[model samples]
Target: MMDENDVKELISSYKNIKDRVEIISNKFDRHNVKLVAVSKTKPTEMIRILYDKGHRHFGENYIQELVSKSEELSELNEIKWHFIGSIQSNKSKILTSVKNLYVVETVENKKILDKLAKSLLNNEENNNNNNNNNNKKLNIMIQVNTSGEESKSGCKPEECLDLVKHCLEDNNCKNSLNFLGLMTIGNPNATPDQPDFKCLVDCKNNISKQLNIPLDSIELSMGMSHDFEPAIEFGSTSVRVGSAIFGERDYSNKK
Candidate 1:
């Protein structure tokens, strides 16, 4: 549904947002940190244009939206998709079924991990490619409830270690999932120094020391459309940026 002019506009928009994020990240020399453009409700036309402009990483919050986009845009070979949303138990299989899904940024407990692990294994089995685990592994991040907000879905800080250990102990999960590090959402109305973002950084440090995993090897996925700059300042290795790049979502005429 997009013309060439619309494609150029989207590319221009993506460059502007990415430049701003880079300006902030450069202050701390976070050259390798990623900007996962959250494109949940955005259409394939917009996403494809950005993909054409060399923005490889894109994120989505809902499984159906993600699957639809991936299916529609299957012609693009190098698009890296991120599931930057809350994973529903009933839709775990569908979420993992996305062909280009690069990271699952909402692993809060062993149950979701167990379900995804089973799904990943089954998928590999069905493909008759069980011998090669490298191609089937899914990257996952443990989300921490730093703010203790009742509305947020994540594991409490106190319970994070136990959950991480459980995920590591399950051979299938450990094999099927590449435990990246941690992720947390910030309150939009809050200031740049969001305590929740800091909590995620600290949690990752503690996990690295406790589990003997290299601190650099573990990444922190924090921040969003509103607070990504602060998240980068707080040692966030990756940010889930959405509206800032895609513009505001229109929730009209829906259930």
Candidate 2:
């Protein structure tokens, strides 16, 4: 039910925040920092409006909603959907099969990663059988619990390096998934020199050094609407921002 007025308003709000994000990123020489507009509880109409306006990267925190939105927006060929939610093991198949899903940014364990990779490999086989040769590998980021928050969903900081190694070296993952980088939902009240953010940076550094991977090749997805600027300042290559652009979510009717 989003009309022209709603569309225009959404675009306006999106541009305002996007501009600020870019300014901060550029100030830190992070010119390639990506803004994944979190569209979790928002409608497909809202997503369509932004897609029509040339916004390609959108994120969702719920798997069902993400799959529904991707299906609805499949006609938009260039749209990129980032799954920023906590993935359930049983739902990996459904998540991997989403059309135009660019990346899953919350991969926490080998079990989930293996499930996702297997599902993606199956998708490849299905596409091959259907004569569709454009089966692209899915991108995945290792989620790190930098703040050691019990409520947060991610692997502990000490365990992140091994996970990254597994994602990079696992045979099935090598063929079916692209190890994109690291993602984290930092502690809310932390300051600019946020410990959570710094821990992610350290994790990336250790991975790069120990795994003999280049630092530049490994990206960091560590910011949300509230702390993206500082996250960017601490070398975040991607930020997931909601609310600031689409306004606060009404979770009463959440999917």
Candidate 3:
């Protein structure tokens, strides 16, 4: 576990990042963007420290690991859990059951959306009938394949509007799934001027306009450890940062 000093260093880093975000926000005159600390592989003790420091929003990229952490810290109500990985259908139930799950960042298909909608509705109904106590609308963000990465898990940009329409039209999904915004992972090597991120922001704007929705509430989730500052500058309501906060990641060391 990370000690107090280590936690302090992490908090300092977060403050620096937040200060940077504020500068970007002021430059653009938009203060609505949010910084979601990506705490995917960090230890629970580190997460507790972050929670204690008033960092309420955190993101995770794996189902099993997130569930394990949730169990270990089941009493924390102020934390918002965001599942930002490729969500499988089999794990939907457990993913939806986590308390205070603020958002899911990788819904690309209607099948998964249907499954999630049913889960949320059933959970709500069960809670209302006194069989359960958890009843909260699970927010969703449609993942868009802005970089055209073959290995990524998002719908192509052209298919996004139709999928959003489907999600809004489906009875089982409409009431349960709150279409919070759009998310994209830029090409790892791309710079701020790269067309990928710009294209995502454009798509987000067009969708919000065409759908006649409030632009402020429609999030544009993009950027990561590498290019999040520019992402915030270009109007990303939510940024999924991982390695920046947790330092470098060693994928080979994972089980």
Candidate 4:
């Protein structure tokens, strides 16, 4: 675990970020924006330290790593886990099994959605029979390819309406997979002051209007370690931050 001093530094960093959130909130007039500290690649010990320091929500990119961390920190009830990475269909069960997992941000296909819906339904049924409190519906955010990158995994802006319609219409899938909002990653070449992030905001507005869905219910999950300020300014409800909170990451070394 991080030393008390390091934990204090981390908390200080978060406070700075929160202050930035306040500035952004004033510009946008939205005060409900939540900062999801991205803790992916950090050790469980560091996670524990941050948890103790008042950060209850975290975002993870890898399924295996997140599952391991979740198991290690099972004692902490207030931690709200968010899976902000691309998810494969084969890993849906593992993702769904995470205790107190509140959000999955990279949902683009029906196969993965079906797996999650089925798993949630099964868990709900099991919970009903055994009166288990552990079972809960998994919230999902449909990813949008605002950058139009070939490598990114998100539904196209034009295609999102159809997908949302299909997801809402499917009886087995609708209730189990709660569509909380939309998520997107910024293009590497895009500037923070430019329209790159605005595209996502525009997309959210158009989709919400087209579908006649409540805009408030649809969260815009964008931004990251580098450009979260601009993201917040663009009216993002939740921002996923990683290296900024955890310091520099050495991807070559993994324990």
lDDT tens readout by residue for model 2, 1-255:
877787788999999988999899779888788989999998888888888888899999999998888888889999999999889999999998888889999999999889998998888899899998988888999999888878999999889888877787899988888989999998899966799999999999898989999999999998898998999999999999999999989999777
Can you give the lDDT of residue 194 in candidate 4? 45
Tell me the lDDT of model 1 at 173. 92
Cα error, residue 83 of model 4, in Å, equals 0.2
Task: Using lDDT, give the best candidate's number.
Answer: 2
TM-score of candidate 2 relative to the true fold: 0.96
Q: Please identify model 1 stretches exceeding 4 Å from their true place.
A: 3-8, 129-134, 253-255
- Per-residue lDDT tens digits for candidate 1, residues 1-255, read 877776766677778878878898899888688989888777887887787778889988778888888999988889999887788888989988898888898889889999999998888887776464545689888888888889999999988887788778889898888887888887767655677877877788788889998888988888787777888888888888777777888756211
- Candidate number achieving the greatest TM-score relative to the actual structure: 2
lDDT of 4 by residue, 1-255 (tens): 567798788777777887887788888887788889888778877778778878788988889888988999999999999998888888887888898898998888777778888878877888889988665457888888988889988988877777677678788688787788888998867865647578777877887898898778789988887887778878788988877777888766442
Candidate models: Cα lDDT each: 0.83, 0.90, 0.83, 0.82
lDDT of 4: 0.82
Candidates' TM-scores?
0.92, 0.96, 0.93, 0.92
- Per-residue error for 159 in candidate 3, Å, reads 0.6
* Colliding pairs, model 1: none
Q: lDDT score, residue 78, model 4?
A: 95
Please provide, for model 3 over 135-204, each residue's C-alpha lDDT reduced to its tens digit, 9 standing for 90 to 100: 6567999999998889988998888887788788889888888898899988888865867878887878
Model 4 lDDT, residue 140, Cα:
88
What RMSD value applies to candidate 2?
1.2
Superposition error at 245 for model 2 (Å): 0.3
